[model samples]
Target: MELQTLYNEYLNIKFKRGLPPVRTKPFEYGLYADDSAGLFLTDHPEETFTNWMYELIPRDPHYISAPDWQPVLADVFQQMDIYDELVLYYLLFTLNTTLSVNSHNAYSTMNDFMKNYSFLQLSHLSEITRLNEEQKHQVRDFFFFYYLYAHPVNEETLYACSFDGQNLVHTKTDIPLERYFTAFHDHYSTNIKEYTEQIAIAPHDIQACKHLTLQLLQCIEGKLAKLNMPEEKGLEAVLRLINDVDQMLQLHDNNKPALFEMMKNFLKEARSTPYRDHCFTTLLQNYASYILFFRFDEIHALVEYFEDTPEWCRTIINKIFMDTIFMERILRQKRIDITTYPNVTQFFEDEAKRIYL
Candidate 1:
């Protein structure tokens, strides 16, 4: 098996060099640590095996695919001088990004590996591989998959391959907006209102609007349920988690007001949940997100009375400072007093000085 060959190759290298046995994982959450034991792992030890240990990564069932194994084994190539471009690329080409983000970043991880070594450290990829015509086509197609076919991909994403003479050089191609947004809902464009405004300049596509509605629906249906379990992760984590959810919920649908009201009602139940001091900061910021999107019915859902706090000055006010035009109108129409965060007024004053001064 390929895993056996890779493992054997590692053992041969270690045996030839007479390095100490690897110490491996007592605890490994994601990836391996290079200097976890110490510089002595990379730096040679005394003839006795006293102060030397390295982690034997890629052991047992921990690594199944290139996304799992390539990152863990990359240090092997870098630390030891066994360069295998074909081996690395073969593993990469076998994987797809639809599974997890680790698959998505395989190219960027390869880029980081390439960025470390200069042309001096590497063999001329052409001389090393010596591929026939058909094999060369395989490499070219891999480029298309790595860039265009990956998740969170956009015009900004770079096409990449490792074995060509170009090796690290890659290209970025422009893609149409609606086609892009429809394929990937909230990956590239977070603020749906921004794209909604752009429809005037390039009118025809309402896919961005449609996608935003879908994203909100999916988040509420699937993701929000996981976070609301205050018993699982505690209330501080809940507040922080929900605030993270706040950033992604921007959308353009006629039903947005109703949907936001539903979300506000969900968060409203948290008042009785156990919480620490700054849980209210996320609550206020969540309300600010609603106000920014012009969803105002449950603007006072968290509390009937609003009071000023220094933390409010730092977070909610500072966040909506640029969008004060929308937020101030929401507060004013809701009969919420201006004293809740005076910095909203001060933000405009600072802007006034920057513009007219």
Candidate 2:
């Protein structure tokens, strides 16, 4: 069944009889008998003249033969939608599987149409559980094909999701219905590239060129919150995005310094701007991780920069302020000798007095 079908079924259960094979009198039909299990609805009973009809529905997608285990949502009305969504998802996967297998003869042609309807086409992904690796791959691909070719999703959704039948596109968002998130990432990459090129040509004009990248960054923050991504693909997209940043950091020529400098400037600017949200912090964290190990000397520079920022925002810099004891604890875990960097020693001492004293 498609999402629409599942949604309709959800509404029906929410409003009327929970599911079919319902009964005002459970005693009348002992148990439901059908290819599809006699799902029971749990809605309040409605009586005509003879028997009182009780709600009954499938306990789950599998349609267990018995109704004893069927859930009652009466107690948790506030969180009812969460339950409904989970159940609907189960219905979606099961029905998709059943229909696909049933249409084996017509599947080849229908599949082309089906693929255009599934989660593979968009950049934003949602979590789809209870599937093995192969099914996960196929479902993702199918959705991508479906989204791009069949139903047209919104621009944010279409572009935010990335889809490739071969790869599992690990993502981490909650709105993966008919979205892939690759499309958005591709556009982001394009913008980043443009910014890089422009920055190279006019290095001194960093302020102007940086806005192109900044705009992309700012857009995604609001856009992603308004938008979202998937589990498998979400992870992949973030890793790839960070990797892209890392790749840029590895640039041995002129662009490398400019990029780093711009990032440093961004960190400072974000502290005061509304754009100082997760997107900013996440990128900042990535840069900090790089600086932590490679540029131990410059670590103090960041510490000094974020001296007034929040503890959560300070991170490694914050750790430094907790006194040498904290650094010792961290060094103990990473097994890095504290003796290697003199700047770190002097820097920590100078600041330790200012902070601790």
Candidate 3:
């Protein structure tokens, strides 16, 4: 019933405001895709019609848990006056990220959505929801889930909810590294590999590596097939799609002898770490998996490789490690005897400031 009402209201606003009718899969993919349509309706349409248009963007299968939906929809209704576009976008985003997770259960799509949207916007939802004492504990638990798991930001938000008040101390939860890697492998595929032998055999010969890269690409395409990922989304295809060959090629160029040395030393060091459970064979397999998977953009080895550099360049190098899954995993593994830091954000920020300053 709500879906029909929402659809009817969308049509009414389109006719009244002379805006384009609803489009399916036509808008460019982004959070703001619906902003212009929303602004057109709110700017010129009748007040009642605009209010109707602001109804909850229904969840798929048209069901939302009472715990989740109540708080979210209340905030949407409360903020509909000023942040209409953002609220509408957030609903669509929630549907895509959290609600759509029934299919992609291994990895939380919420993390990606959190990366793109400002925490201030999220805090608004956190702020306006009026929860009872019993329900309040769940909010507190989920607060840590967002703070720890969401994309790290440089500075924290100012306005905080009761659950996420200023300077609230939250403990990070430790989940097994194998669990994370397994989920990631399942999502992408475990057949991904590092092409280590290929890299070692022809370090300086880019031509030789090209054939190896093509073989690697074919291997990836085959794995992606098992996962039902589109045929056109092979490693080379993603490179073309993003038009970022230079960065990846530069990564490839540096991998010749430099990457091999880094991998050997890193493996040597890992033998003593808590991750000692995974032998070199398993470690090499997973490392290779990530290298091939991260081929889309900003490709770096699971551990980065730096060519000959002076000691003073260490600060600059650490800054480069900021804001990557590789760095996050390194910190989590506790392998690399990095300077002790409280959290990934703090460590990354402190290192980043050294370079930026």
Candidate 4:
């Protein structure tokens, strides 16, 4: 009733494909037959079963040559408790010493030999899925750590390790140009007003002020057509703007004063830059309108900010104008015509629902 003898018998029963005579005890024979079939088709059928034998059976240290057992060992080790600190230390030492001191061909030969056993090892692991929770956890942890050590530089392997640990993956992609601009405009127009109001009433609320600054940037982005800008330029502009705002927010103690000073310098520089006159003009109009509506007291503050430069501010204002005008043209071109409406509010409500919902 040795474990190896039992495994060999089970393997023979399963892989040989012919059942022995039906015994008087039909139920026992049926159960054995079922178990045999299960083992043969199990994940890593060869490795799992062989490892099970190795673990359960007491044998000479070199009873099974390393070459003969290396493949199954490597495969099973991944799913083993051999990652325990003590075990890991020993395993690392063994792997390093064996490969380093051995002949140059030793590593390749070992790898080639291991590759040939992959199918069996995989089958063996699959067969053990029916094991209890504790057993399964041990198997999974072993395999994970094993693969981690083996393929340390492989991105996919690293991803698998993190996935196993965190159970989540994140992906990022560029927003479509047209939709990006529209979304930016919508968000800016809605949120920037609220943000500007916060700045006027409670400027000390650093977080809110920071959020508002970000919303303004988002608004500016919405106004600018990303498609018109070179990809690198667009990316660079966004990154620089965002980073500046973020850094300003992080320096909360001096942020409000710093922000005001920065805005002043920006306006001054804008006014002096003839080449950027159009962009300045557009920004100025938006600022003027925004100032008049929400932060009238800050008008003088803004004027002071812009006093040093005339031409650069004019360019910025012109750019803002172009954006607004371009957007207006696009809207007019794409406007939905409604010849008849009983009530203006109801008409708008329906139109809004159609477009948004």
Looking at candidate 3, what is the lDDT of residue 221? 19
The RMSD (Cα, Å) of candidate 4 is 33.3
lDDT values, one for every candidate: 0.30, 0.32, 0.28, 0.29
lDDT of 4 by residue, 188-271 (tens): 344544546222222222222223223322222222111111112213432232223223233322443454454445555433
Which pairs clash in the backbone of model 1?
A: none
For model 1, what is the error of residue 239's alpha carbon versus the real structure, in angstroms, after optimal superposition? Answer: 4.8
The worst-scoring run of ten residues by lDDT in candidate 4 lies at 95-104
For candidate 2, the clash count comes to: 63
- Report the C-alpha lDDT of model 3 over 94-192, residue by residue, as the tens digit: 222221112112243334333222221222222222334343343333333343345322122111212322223111212222222223223222222
By TM-score, the candidates rank as 3, 2, 1, 4
The sequence of per-residue lDDT tens digits that candidate 1 reaches over residues 82-112 is 1232222222222211111122144554332
Listed in order, each prediction's TM-score against the native is 0.23, 0.24, 0.25, 0.18
Q: Model 1 scores what on Cα lDDT?
A: 0.30
Number of clashing pairs, model 3?
Answer: 1
- Worst ten in a row by lDDT for model 2: 47-56
